[model samples]
Target chain A: MITGMDRLAAAIQGKKSDRIPVFCNLIDQGAKELGMPLKEYYSNGENVAEAQLKMRERFGYDNVWSLFYVGKEAELLGCKELIYAKDGPPNVADFVIKTHDDIHRLEVPDDISAHPAFQETLKCLRILKSEVGGKQAICAYVTASMTLPALLMGMDRWMELFMLGPASVRDELLEKCSDFFRKEITAYRNAGADVCVYANAFGSTDFVPMRLFRELSLPQMEKDLKPVGIDGVVYYCGGARMNAVLEQVIDRLGIGAYYLSPLDNISEGKKIIGNRALTCGVINDIMLIGWTMQEVRDEVRRMLDAGMPGGKFLFGTLVMPYNIPEENIRAMLETAYEYGACVEEATS
Target chain B: MLEDVITAYNEAVFDTDRERALKVIHDAVDRGVSPEDVVFKVVIPAIEQMIKSISESFDANLAQHFMTSQIAAEVTEEMLARFRKAPEVVGHIVIGTAQGDLHSLGKRIVIGCLKSLMIDVTDLGVNVPPEKFVDEAVARNAQVIGISAMMVHTARGENGCIMVRELLRKRGLEDRIKIIVGGAPYRYDLELYKTVGADASADDGITAGRVIAGLIKEVRR
Candidate 1:
């Protein structure tokens, strides 16, 4: 029997699989499913790991991607104002860098692995590796470099820097952000992750226009990601043109797979991505939560029909909504497995 | 002269030349360009051009957009200071992103729209508490309070839109102050308005401004 990891690896490498591996960029949904308060789940690695595994089992997810939230790496770097709430991921409470001069004092710890949040994430990866290991692909997550800076400075201030700051200042920040992410990717790879998923939400044309994405977001991402020898996937949300951006990242930057949002047409995305990389998704997170099970099943069948004919497709969601029902999630998975099954390649 | 200033402002901002953009605005004002005309004819057009380009799929780079917004914001402040009587206020509104949500790109865009429409807008900034929104609206005697929550948790969380609605009622100002909720969360489901007890919701700034105008009238009547 081919394991889920084998199937996913095969799909990513442009080989055939027996079925489309169905999972999601599921993190907080795990806590929501287990009825665990997000505050409790995010506070410790063991708790987060257990909740994720339980969610996978309950939802029949083929693979497990573990992440705490968007700003964990920043929190680890001595950002003091981390906000912990009742049932959602913690936010960077107050900005660490308030002025342009503060950029000079920014430092990356020599021993990143020693930071408590980093340690907790590694602990979660280790737990998942020990528990699921070869059976499920243990994917590690990191926020993309272009966006990680906003974790230290707020998003508005970061946008101000990108918009109004000097080119030298912007480049310096990009270099620092990329370097920190390099440390994060290295830590995740060293800790036994099967794949490292880099999230670049700002790269989407929805926020930063395509020109800035190409000039600022892309180069920084390529510089940071090119050194990582581990298999990598990208997550981006934007308008329809995002498919073209995904192609550049895969072809130019060497990412192996992409998790797309609903804004891009999957059929067009598959055509653009072709055999170069694996593609996993096109669901609107809002629809995942707001739509009924029947609506979920119908959309699942439609997406499966559109993408499963070719290789390198996985059934997934853009982002899982926090309040999404287990029944709706189960409906998505059931429909995918039933409708998304592919022909198994003959073994030697 | 208005056309010349608009073109100069457009090219200056698009080129990301903040100094040149500010110089043109000051020069315009020095040359007998009323502050209101500079706003309506030059600055507003420049910002509108950027927004139009973005919608048309032209790559109006992020920096240029922010730079143009900053110029427009500064000009709006100047216009309010110099000519409060020129453009009659359409309505008074208090706006901000909800508590626990620090993202403000959406709120800023909406603020720009409201300011351009000559509505008196007082921004409460990001991570604003629900009661703070009510208190600000009451202080300003504003007819509308527009709250933004971009993500799921912030849109529906305990201290989010739900909290804002209950707080407004608790303060006995629910009927007087209409709520217009927006951002990514409400764009997908207008039903969120009913859930959050907002009088209206809009997906974009122009629609938001128009909707808030109508909402103000409904509240006053």
Candidate 2:
């Protein structure tokens, strides 16, 4: 009997799994399902882990990763004003780096162990490892370094820096972020995280040019992930038509898994990712929100048909929308189970 | 001289040379290029040409797109400041990201697009409340209210455009001001715009400007 963890590990290693593992980005939806306030669930680690586990169990999925707000780490690192909302994660209300002098003053946290967000995330990882480590894979999430300048400085300023400043200025910011993430990844590893998932929205083709995405983001990601001694890392660059970047990242980064957005063409994505790294998304979030259950099932079947022929596929969404219907989610998993198993049988 | 300025500024923007780009504009103005002519003829055309070049190439990335637009916007702002006279406002518009959606890359790009077209825009900044949209539109007598919601969660329900639409109707400004939405969510489903009660939606910033401009024309006519 193959455990869910075993199936995910197998899929990541480019081996034939018992079936295609279903990866649901169910952070907000998990809180809503458990009838917990978004504020409460996001404030503490135990609640975050508990909500994620419940979501995984309900869906019979292969993994449950921590999906906290992207700004938690930034907030801990002295971004003063954070907007906590009832519907979503906290965001930076004000930026700290208002001038060139501020960038020079900013440094990686002196003690990563003492950061409240770090402590909370470690607690979440420990709880997941102790409770569900036997059956489900436990991954920990961190905002990628390339995406953090906007948190320290407002996004408009960050975009201006890219437009106006020398590449060195942008690199200095990324380097500081990289150092912080290195320590964060190490902390998560020490806490027994099975994989380190890096969410680099800025690294996506939607935000950065290919030259910068390749020249800046890829090298910074390599530096961040190289220290993580976990079995694999999940790199998510959120946007469509990123295969050009994805192809380079897969070749350069040592990560064993990739979360290509639903906006991406999955077949071409699969070809870019190849068998070395497991590809884990294709179903656009809008479809899950607006499509009927039958349409959801059909979409899942189509993704599976395209990806399941190869051994390196896991089913997931781009960004799981809040309050997605339980039935549509169930429909996606069922389609994956039924058709994904057929591919499994043939490969085995 | 204008063509030389545009070509030189284009190279500066392409090379990410902000100083040179600014110098080119300033020098052109020193040679008696009116500020408006500099904006309408040189700055806007240079940025538009850059955007067109990027779109033609499959390898163009986000940096080129953002950098080109940012230069155009900055140049427009600089010249407008120097001139000390606001160009005749072709149309008044208000724009922002809806409440809880902090993503502003799309909104900023749209701002550049609108400014380049000589639209008088008052940006309310990110995380704008629904009532604020109506309040500002009414106060400014704006022709359009542009709302951006990047994430699906933000795009749906009260957190995003839907709230703005409902408030617009309640304030009786729904018919007076056209609502246009753009972002990742709307790019996939234009019907989502209809559900949110937006008059129109565009996937890209340039198209959003064109769509909003057309809708404004329809309204004033």
Candidate 3:
């Protein structure tokens, strides 16, 4: 039988796996669960990587995200100038885009050797690729480009553009952001990441409306995803009701997996995407934030039952937080190990 | 006529295509829509639609998320500019980034929603100390102050509370205005806000808007 790691790499690449993969979004529980100090992990990349390696070795989960989240991408962009936050990733300097003119003047960054966080991300991936990527799979993380301009340009006047100008102009901004991510994704894959994770932490269920989904996000995702080819996980924020949108994304673009938090009605999603895409994540983050080991085990059991009847189902928490307790994480991994053992797929 | 405008506005807003929205607003106005009708009927509904879209569909892509939002903000300002009548109550609210937090998305959404309510909003942008919010409230004689933080760690936000206390101590204007907080980090409850000694806390803009309106009314009464 193929090992869980081999299975995950296969399923992610649309190949066959031995059994289901025990997915662990360790980035969520890195600070607390792994016993790494958040301040130190944020300050020093080597410490952060060491901490991540510790969690992977300790938990023995199938995967590990290179860093806390995609703040590194924002750091790569020139928008994060006032970054004195050495304790963590550099944050957007100030949300003052100054004027509409600032939007046009801003250029999406692409030079990776010069991008500090991108370089750090690549370095970590390189080390991991040598250490673990072949053993399992390594997901290289990048943030959405348009998200930053809004962060940098300020949301207020940027919104006004929809009312004030031609749609083509806004389209231009979306295009530039897409180009930056595509380039970065290529760089990461070339550097030896097994998969690339398209992460947008701000994309929540109640966050943005639907039409923008079709025009702006979907198009950009489709465009960049084509180059990413087969091995990419579309890690989106949750809006469980937007099943139609999710189905459309998988149908329009050949996404390898969908990593979401709330699985409010995942059975329905399983039917919607069929075997075309793998399903990842459903355990609620709040449960792990304060639950005991037993409680965490129960939640994992519940999600595995609800989400993993079929072969392509990977086990993950609802969402990972950087501050969840270690015992909770231990429970989560142990539960997956116990229940995920050689399950027969209900799939015919 | 207003109903028709609202329907069209709501339908088109989700697309995040401001051009279609511009056409809808102009059409509503050409039909002799009042500025109030245009804003409340045509613009706000579209804004709400766009907001819903951002939350659901386009959210995974932060670039689209911000692009759609920026378009929403520019649209709000443009629509308001067309209104010549003295706004019924050009209510003023001072908004800012909480101390030690620099995220600007939630705060911008709040300001946009308030402006659609025809309330004049004063956004201090990001990373402003809590003192700045209070000072702006005092100078503008602003009726309300809004602070937002997306960071989870409480220590940073505790600094924001200190800024508020310092503001009151220096200006003696503690009773003159109400303070509100919102953002992703505000998970536990409104008590976190109360614990911060804020008048209220909310995660989303609509709730914040309704609560602000209610608080303003109570203060006036």
Candidate 4:
């Protein structure tokens, strides 16, 4: 039997597979599937690993994640509190870098693998590696240096310092963040994560002006990724449209995969990406909350029609909402599998 | 003279030079420009123009918007103090992040823009509940309630704008106090305002001031 990893590898290498790989980015939804609170489900690697294995088994998707939550990254970097929610993903309750002085004081742990917050994450990765190891692709989330400060000090203050910078302070904070990112990426790769998603919302025009992206965000990201290399790295912009910068990112970063936002046109994205890297077309899962089963099926077909023509494309979803009915998910996956089949007749 | 001040202020703000932007207003004020004229004719229009210029890449220019609104609010505060007589307030609004939603950047941007637009805004802070939104709006006799929700669950969740709308209807205040929502979810789904029981929604904080002003007019009428 063809494994999920095989399909993913085939897609990445621009080779034909049984079907295009489907990545269901159901992070918090895992807790819902396990009949547990998000906090409890995420507190231990066993629970998270179980949830990932079970969800992938149930939905038959192609990828499992090692991401507990985005806020955990902040906790590893001195954020003292995280506000967990019953129905939503957790968020940073208190910014670690509350003031300029706090930025100076913030330190990326010298050995992040020993950090308490990351213990559960490493456990989860080990479990997934033990269970599915070579059969399924394991994704690890890493916030890029340019966007990590938003988690540390909140977006408002980060913007203030970034736009109205006393350059030395902002640069100092970014350097620290970049160092953390390098360590985090290296740690995850060593611990069995096959893919490290380099998430930087500011990389897209949706977050910063083109000039700022080129001058500030790009350079910081380049520095952060230089040590680890970009071979198994996937570039993401936090569900923001990135087609505007797709070519530039490809030219500069030489990243292996691009997770195109729902806002981006699949055809346009494929045209830009060409054979340079794998293109993952993400569905607007927020709309899935209200869309009917038929609507969901239609959207899946539409996306496949646009993205499946090329061999390097993968069908995916953004972080799905907890309220999306099981039937809608069923409809989405069923349609993806039905249309995504790689029979010569279907492909031709 | 006001046009020159507006041009200079726009340039300073576009460059994200807070000090230069403030100096432009201060110099205009020292040159016998009435504070009221400076605000109504110069500051507001400068912000409006800035919004138009950056409309294509609004999210990327958040820093610019944040700085522009902050400068506008500072200038408005100084001018309001120097007004020969109290300027006519355009409207009263209470705004905050919806319950279970702690994202405050959007709400802060909206509050800053509204303040300079002569809207008497009471910030309720983040993670505000339905009862608090209604109670505070009623207590302050505010014309509009603004809820910011960065996530879909909070935007359409039970304790978010939906519950706020439910409370207003239960208390017979729906007609008297209109609701306006701004955040990522609404921007992603334009018609979400109607679904969330809001009178209107805006793409960004600068446009939010105008949207709430319209809602306030509807409430008054």
Scored by TM-score, the top model is 4
Q: Which pairs of residues clash in candidate 2, taking residues 3 or more apart in a chain or in different chains? A: A208-B62, A208-B63, A209-B62, A209-B63
DockQ of 4: 0.54
Q: Per-model i-RMS in Å? A: 2.9, 2.8, 6.3, 2.2
User: Whose lDDT is greatest here?
Assistant: 4
Question: lDDT per residue, candidate 3, A203-301, as tens digits?
Answer: 333334555565556666667667657465565553233354666677676666777546345777666666777777566654465577877788777
Q: What ranges in model 2 sit over 4 Å off? A: A166-169, A227-231, A342-348, B1-17, B23-36, B47-61, B80-87
Tell me the deviation in Å of residue B67 in model 3: 11
Task: For candidate 4, give fnat to 2 decimals.
Answer: 0.49
Docking class of 4: medium
TM-score of each: 0.90, 0.90, 0.77, 0.95
Which candidate number would show the highest DockQ if scored against the true structure?
A: 2
Candidate 2, DockQ score (0 to 1): 0.55
lDDT accuracy of residue A140 in candidate 4: 94
lDDT of 2 by residue, A1-348 (tens): 787887786776666666887776777765686677877777688888888887887788787776577677777678767776666556677787888778888878866767865777778887888888868877767777777787788667887775667667777887888888888777766777776677777668666666567666677777767765435577776545456577677677756787777667778878877776788765776667778998988888888878877677888766667756778888888888788773342232
The candidates, ranked best first by lDDT, are 4, 2, 1, 3
| Docking verdict class for candidate 3 | incorrect
